[model samples]
Structure formats: structure tokens, C-alpha cells
Target: MRPPSELTFRAVALGLLIGCLLCFTNLYFGLQTGWISMMSLQSSLLGYLISLLIPSVSPLTPQENVILQTTAVATGTMPLAAGFVGIIPALGLLDRAKDGMDPIHVLWWDGVWWCCAVAFFGVFLAAPLRKQVIIKEQLAFPSGTATAQLISVLHKIPPPAAARPGLRHRNGHTGSEDGYQAVRTVEAGGDIDEDAEDPGETDQKREEIVRAGWTTLGWSFAASGSMTLAAYFFPVIFAIPLLGDYLASKWLWTFSPSLSYVGQGIIMGFPTTVSMNLGMLVGWGVLSPLSKKAGWAPGDVGSMTDGARGWILWVALAVMCAESVVSLIPVVLELLRVLRANRDGHPEEDLETETEDRLVPMKWVLWGTGGSVVFGTIIVWYVFGSEGIKPWATVLGFGMGAVLSLLGVRALGETDLNPVSGLGKISQLVFAIVQPGNIVANIIAGGVAEAGAQQAGDLMQDLKTGHLLHASPRAQFHGQLIGSVLSIFVTTTAYSLYKRAYPIPGPNFPAPTAYVWLSLARLLRDGQLPAYSGTFMLAFGILGLSVSSLKTWAGLQGKWWAKWVPSGVAFAIGFLNTPAFSIARLMGGIVEFWWRKRTGGNRSANITLIVIASGFVLGEGIVSVVGLVLRTFGIGVASCWGCAEGVCPSC
Candidate 1:
């Protein structure tokens, strides 16, 4: 028997099941709003609770929890990768409708192929960089760090059988080994010192802690779920006008009463949310109105070429992309500076424990990465050739993706902000220069690069969690593979289902992310920026660069003010998202800061607050997905025309 490790079939299967259920919620919201709740925290809790519920099953081990989250996150985030919401739909928007059918429409299998082709390559890339990024640098991949902490809190009880050989630490024993030493020593036929207290007392104390953790989480979920269900029936509850009903409607200024938004804000935290609000104030309060009044953007609200939204996107991308490149420069140079030292060796490897034995080896990284390039090249040539995507684009896209992903993932690790807009625009520009005028190639190439960036960032986070928990990297890698396979099906089926029931780029689903991509593609295809937005773009780009430089300088000096500086990438997201989103997130941040202060430094209380936020996010997601399934067969509301695509008001 495989010694009760993280790679068990049970954990992977359960994770996939959870991920499948979770995918719908993300798909619904990722298009509806270009954000999805982070699935890691909720899935870890869900897996822990489920392990306890299932009779005769061994309690979920900490290592196994990493696997559970790995699969769940991988599967849950695939819709955006598969391009239902953005890339594919944007492609359709750019290409004229042929006989009233959208070219974005595709069979489920093809959708899977399209997504998986580039996604797996990134997964392979993450393995080699793990030692460098996660271990050596010890950067804070916040979600992964949080997930590891949560798993630790839940698995207070000892593993049922023998513990694995220790993943040796600086003290030659892990903190876990130290904590469980009293119990494990007795189990392993070693004589216990009489002074050592009763092992049963330790178990009892741990049981109480575990009990309290689960109870608090359960109540949070129950409370949030009840409220979410109630709000579902009362659609008015979802929005509370912040600027009065008329102004709220006109300016996209509303306080979303959703706890999910609050939870997201809590995850995002104060500095980031403040920056987002700053962007909203400048973009929505000032720039948008100014542009519209000047007739610079003369089309309807949704028009990409002549609307404020489209004009804002160019300026936002400029700020974000410029900052991403500029900020990434120092980090890239630092890596290059140390490249010789790393090539010689990391002495830390000599200290790594048995856990390293289970890791995805360096050889696999070389073989798998090479294979991915070949595989992706084939995919681009064969699958997308009709649309004008060349094999070279995919090859070069992977090269850019590999380079850019390091920056994106490092950003993700340091700040928990994945700079998707910057990643996409950078990739788009690269392809625009190389494969000029082929919109499909431009878009798909970016998609490929974005996939690498997304997957690389995601996998690095998972590896961080695994490294902390001493989980097998190979096991987590396998979980990622399983999740990727499952994602293809989940994303494809979701696209098919939603497309059948709703217009993708239509009213209810504005596909904010896709619109950005589509509009940018058109400009590149036409070889011109929006008429009057050049000045705005330049001004913001300078602002972003200046801020990045200041922050970087402050960071090196260890200035206290460095932490408070607004992130250029996150600030840019303010333009990408609605003002309402920033308002809600701001409210959530206030709630978190206020509650944390009230907790008076109680760790458990802080955790309980996190549980409440997670509950709200998960509850909303569950409710949204359930309603989507019901409406698929026309089971619920009558004539949801806002959801009825071009049949509705806005589109």
C-alpha cells in the first residue's frame, strides 16, 4: 500500500468533484464580472469538513490538503483560460457573423483541446522554478501561505500511522516534528521520559482546537448561505445605490450588499483596495465623464472604438503594462545576476529532507517543458490554422509566456495580485509586431501566453503551499495535471451551457475582460490607437512608472511607507472593473481592518473572521451556480431577458 500520502485517488477525486461544482460559479461570475472567488481557502475547508464526515475514512492529512486545493484551484479557474468569456467571444466579435452563427461556438472537445494545449506547458515550467522562487526566495504567495496555515490549523490531530521521514529543517526537525514528538516517540517504540506529560492530554487539547475551528467555519457557511439564498430571491438586495438610484445606474456607482464582495476585499486587503478606489475616482469620476463630454468617445456606452469604456481600456493597459515591464526589470536583472550562483548550486538542497525525493525531478522539467513546446506548436498549427494561427506564434508565445510568467508569478507571490491585464497586453503587443494584421493569431497567441502566465502563477502558489506543509511536489503536480484535464471538460461544457442559454458578449454577460481583448485586437489590426486617448495613456503611463520606481526604491530601503504604496497593476484594474466593484471592495476592506482591530490580536478570532469571509464567497458562488443549472432547462424565472442576450435592455 502507498503509505497514506497526498497522491491518494480519494483526495484527487474528491477535489475534482468539488472543483467541478466550483467551476460553474467561477464561470458565471468570471464573465458576469471579470473576477472569481479564490477557490483554495474554501476548498481546503470543504475537504477537511468532508474528511471528518465520511465514516471509516482516515482524517485528511496536511499533505493531502495541499493536493485537495491544488486540484480544486486548477479545475475551478479554467473557463477564462478556455476563452469562453473573453478570447473566443472577442474573436467572434471581431469576425463578422456568418449566417447568424458566432464562430466562437465550438464543440466541447475542441474547447478542451484549445485550453489544455497551452495550459500544461506552464505546469511543467513551475517545477524547476520551485526551489528558486518558493524555497530560496521564500516569497509570500499569499493564497498558498494562507492555505498552508489553514491546513495546519485543521490537522491538529496526529496522522493515523507512521509519519513520513521528516522534510528536515534548519533545526534538523520540522516544527511539526517538534510538536508531535511526544506522541510519535511513544508510537515508535522509544522510551518516553517520565517528565513528558501525558500524550492523551495533548490529543485532547488538539481535539478541542479542531472542534472549535470546524464549528466556527460551519456556522459562518450556514449564516452566509442563508443570507445568499435570501438575496437570490430578492434581487434588489444585491445592490444598494450609493449615488442614488439614477446616478448609480448611470455611473455604475452602487454599494453591492454581497458579502462575497466584502470577502474579496478582505482577501485583497486595505492598501490594494485603497489603490483600486483611487483608480475608480480618477477613471470613473474624472476621465470617463471628461472623455464623453468632449465627444472623444461618441458611440453608445458599450462601443469599444467610440465608448468611454474602450477609451479607458487603452489608458489602463498603458499604465498597467508599462509598470509591469518597468517593475519587472530589476527583478529580472537580479535573477540574471544570481543565475551563475544558482547554476553552481544551492547549498540548501543538501539540507532538504526526504520530501525532495518525491518532488518532480529536474529531468522531468527539461523533458516536460520541451514536450509542451512541441505539443503547443502542433495545437496552434493543426487546431487553429483555419483561423490564421501559425505554429511559430505558439512557439514564440510560449517563450514570451515563460519570461513574462516569472514577473506575473513573482507579483502574485509578493502581493497576491496576478497582473492579467499587463500579461495579456504585453503578449498582444509582441504578436502584433510579429504576426501583424492576423487578429486570430494575435488573440490566440496572447491566449497561449496568458495561459502560461496564469498556470505558472497558479502552480507556483500551490507549490508554495506544498513546500510549507511538506507535501510531495510530485503529488501536487499530478493533482494539477488531473485538474487541467478536468478543467478542459468543465470549461467547455460550461461554455456550451451558457452559450445555449445566454448571449456571451450580450447584455447580462458583458464579458468585461473579453471586450478589452477584442478592442485591443482591433487597434492592433488597424495599427492605430483610439483617437484622443493617446494623451491619457501617456499621462497614466508616466504616473504608473513614477509610482513603481518610488515603491521599488522604498522597498529596497525597507521604508515603512513602501507597504502603503498603491500597486500600478491593481490600480489599473480599477479601470478594467466597474466603479461599483471598487466601492464594494472598499467596504469589505473597511470591514476587515475594523474587525481585525476589534479582535485585539486574537489569532483564532482573526481566523474566524476569515472563515466568515470565505463562507460568504463560497455561499454566493454556490447559489449562483445552482441557479444557472436550474435556468438551463428553463426551470426558474420567467423571461430573464437581461440574461436573454440581445433580447435584453443593455446590449
Candidate 2:
């Protein structure tokens, strides 16, 4: 058996195909919701099934499946690293709103290079983390562990049923789902050994295992796409003002039916929805009215400056910043503990699992690490120029990315959580100090850190899966390189396509996360704090820090009420976006919660709705992309609200 081809042509081709699909899928979702879920099982299973479905192609080896996921996962993160979903689009938002400042136009190649600058260093840096985190420490990279177990069972390879995680998100968080159960049904019935089941039972059970998510995923996608399409023709049905026209127009509290946000909400979860609702109450319910009544010169509700929106934006940033910094302390300490406990964080581990021959070469690591930073810095310098970010600052950003990548990898290993968003806050603060009042420098520097952490964390997680399946680290690394090279074009084009379709940061594609980045950059550059905003920032900041600290401490102490505490990240996002968006998402979470509770947490019961929710996201997002393509050749309705109403000036 010719050593089970690890990085074969078919695997790479299919992986690239699925990964590009996901790149578009995730970017569309991430822009609206300010978050993106991991698509490990989604991508891995897609490859496995596709290979199985094809008669001519060989059955997917466990190692080949790992490559499929590695490529897809790596490629999926590019839109974010390239700053399309957040920082880059935010520059457009900041430019449009920030009066008297020269506008920064980010071209297609600029986006590609900007993404390149921020993404590759992390991939190279992740190589060293593998031994430390996955091998010696043997930290549960829970999802990676889950994926390995699933692949083993699927291939009829005897796998240990022990160490299975109970039902949770594909990313290992309990918050979201997308046929998470289908890809990870091992959690429900334990590993499926062929010898243990009845005659022809294994295949039947496998179909039953994946059918709920697999079938519903397609159906729900089509259904949601239909809804989005129907809404395009009848905008009134989509734009319902449940709170009446006044609050809907002025305060952004309308109940506009959007499947994209609802699907995002389902993935984000019930607790996050609660936090968002709370944020809505504080931001729109109370503050917006008060700011206007007190003659704060509040303009439009979504205004970035000299409006009620501007005032809450500062408060949200402060709270988010405080919470992110506080949460990151424990993660940093964990990495420190690993380093201090073991000399070079590599005490000892079994060599049977990995010999010198299978692991990545030392020279490759050194060259990749050194070369990526230098290359990324030059790209940043060339794209943004001195007027944007200086080379010294670019180096600093990438360095922080490398360091944070370690912490990110560590966090993912232990908890299966990637705190890239919060971790990136550290870069924003550093850049604020390095070049105060330089908005472009502030965002791009932060973008570098966020982008690096995201890419590195994702790659390490993929590496963890490879490690478990006895796949070659070298093969996975090369697969990742191919994916990264592909993402440069795929994600950049996706960004441009979406930009042309609608207002980059306008309604429909609110770009909630981008608003988060934009608010912070606007603050650092303008230095104009709303009246009494200092008090608000201070109070909220302290509260955020305290709440996050207490939550962490409570979790350690195993307190019953620990899970009840609001997520600081979700709360900040609520403040950043509209009430309708959060409300729609709340509906999704509520549906999932109802299903889980009604079925008493049965895996099969939850799997159906989870699949539908996933479909809703892909369905609506992909439809928008399709519409964009059709319209380029002059198809579909002339325009939606953005173009029809003169709401989006650029469009």
C-alpha cells in the first residue's frame, strides 16, 4: 500500500475547490455578524464524501482527508487576514465619515498584499508550536481530536473511543453549530468500529449519522436563498418595522427579516444573544434618546461622529478593550507556564508518533519565519506606504503576531478557543502608542496582529488534526502553502465582488466587526471624545474587566453560575451593530435552544436544526454573491435599498 498518498492531486484540487467556496461563505457571514465559525468537519466531511462518491478516485486516506481540511481551513481565513471583513472595509467606512482626513483607497492588489503581509508569518510560526503544544504537552486541541476520531472511524481504522468531547460547536465552543453533530457523531454513540456493529450496519449508521446535517444543509441553503431572493423583489417584506417606523428609521430597532443574521445568531448562541440584547438596551434604548434630548447634536443613528452612535462607539470600544486585555492575561500566563515548566516547552514525548523524517525541517522553519516577516513588512510598506504604516511598525506588528500566535495556539490547544479578536487588541494599543493619531497606522498594525494570530491559530489546529491521524507535518505544511497562495486571489476577489454589489459597510452587509475596528481607529486618530464619554468609557471599561475576570475565576472554581455571565465580546458587538441584526440572531439561538431542550439534548434532534442553520447562512450569503454576478452582466432587479433610496452614496 504505497504509504497512503498524503498530499495528492485530487485531494489538493478538491480541497481548493471547497476552500474557495468557504472563503466566500465565511466572508459574507463574518461581515454581517462580526464572527466566523470553524468549518473543520464541514470541509473535511465534504472531501471525504466527495471522494467516496467518486468511483474512479481512491477512497480518501485519513492523511488525505487531513490535507483537505488543512487546505480549506487555511484558505477560509484569508478574507479576515486580508482585512476584507473588518479592518480594510473599515478604512473605507472611516474615510467616508472622518471629515477633513484624506481618504485611503485600498485597491485589489493592495488587499492581496495586505493579506499576504499579515497572513504568512503566522503559518511559518505555527511549525514550532506543534511540538510544544501537540506532542509533548499533548493538549487536547479538542476539535482536532474530534476530527481525528471521526476520520479514523470513517476509514474503518480502529480508533480509541476515549477522549470524545460531548456535543459542542465544530470549533469546540458550545455556542454554535452547522451539522456539527453530523461530522462529529462519534460524541453521541462513541467511535464506530466495523467489527462491533450488525451486518451492513456500519454503512446504514454512517448515513444516518451524516444524513440529518448533510441533507438539511442543502435544503436549508436553497430555502434561505429563496427567501433572500424573494426579499430582493419585495423589499417591504424584508424591512418590517415591528417597533413602528420612527424607532425603525431613527434608532435602528426594526425587525427586518434577514436569514444571514439569524443563521449567524444560531451559531453565536443563546448567551451571546442575551448579551447583545442587553447591549441594545443600553446603547439604543437608553443612550441614543438621552444624547439627543441633551442636545448632543446627534445626527443619523449610525453616524460615526457627532451622533449618538459615535458616543456609544467609544463606550463599546472601551468595554471591549478592557475585556479583551483582561481575558488575554490568563492565555499569556498559560504560554508562560508551558515555557517555564519545560525547557523550550519540549520536555519529552514518544518518538514513535513522529520521527525526524516526518516532521518539518528546522531550516524550513527558520527560513519561513524570517522570510515571511521581512516579506510581509515590505508588502505593508509598499501597499500602505509611510503615510499609512512605517516599516519599523510593520515589523513590530508581525513580531506581536508571532508572539500572540503562540498564545493563540496554546489557547486553542487547551480550550479549542481562538482569542484572536481580543489578542489583536494588544496590537491596537501598541500602535496607538507608536503612532498616535495616525488612524491608518493604528488599524493596519492591529490588522497585522489579528490576521497573523487568526492564520497561525487555524494552521496549528489543522496541524493538530494531522498529528493525530499520523499525517506528515511536511505534507500538511505544503498544503497550507498552496491554500495560502490560492487565498490571495480568491479572498481578494471575493472582497471586490461584494464591494461592487452593495455598500461595503452599509446596511445588508453591516460589517459589524469592521465597525468595531473603525470605531477604535477613529478614536485614536481624531482624539475627540463625546461629552461625559470619559466617564462612560471608564465605568464600562472597569465593569468589562471585572466581569471577564470574575467569569474566568468562576470557571476555575467550577461555580454553577459561571456560564451565566455575559460575553464581553458579544456585548461589544451588540453596541457596534443594530438591534435588528442582534434580534434576528437571537431568534436563531432561541430556535436551537428550543430544539435542544425539547429533545433533551439528543444529538440527532439538535443535528437537524443545526444543519438548517448552517444552510441558512450559506444559502443567503451565496445567493447575494450569485446576484452580484448576474447583475454584472445586467440581470435581476435594478437595486435594493442602497441604490434605490440613495442611502449608500458610493453605490
For each predicted model, how many residue pairs clash, with residues at least 3 apart or on different chains? 0, 0
lDDT value for model 1? 0.67
For each candidate, what is the lDDT? 0.67, 0.70
* Count: clashes, candidate 1: 0
lDDT, candidate 1, residue 121?
A: 82
Pairs with backbone N, CA or C atoms under 3 Å apart (clashes), candidate 1: none
List where candidate 2 sits over 4 angstroms from the true fold.
Answer: 1-4, 94-101, 149-162, 165-214, 343-352, 557-561, 600-610, 630-651
The digit string of per-residue lDDT tens for model 1 on 310-429 reads 778788777766766665666666677568677887555543544556878788889989998998788667666745677766788889988877777776655455565567778888
Model 2 root mean square deviation, Cα atoms: 4.3
lDDT at 129 for candidate 2?
76
lDDT, model 2: 0.70
**Candidate 1 off by > 4 Å:** 1-4, 97-103, 136-142, 157-234, 239-242, 340-351, 410-420, 635-651
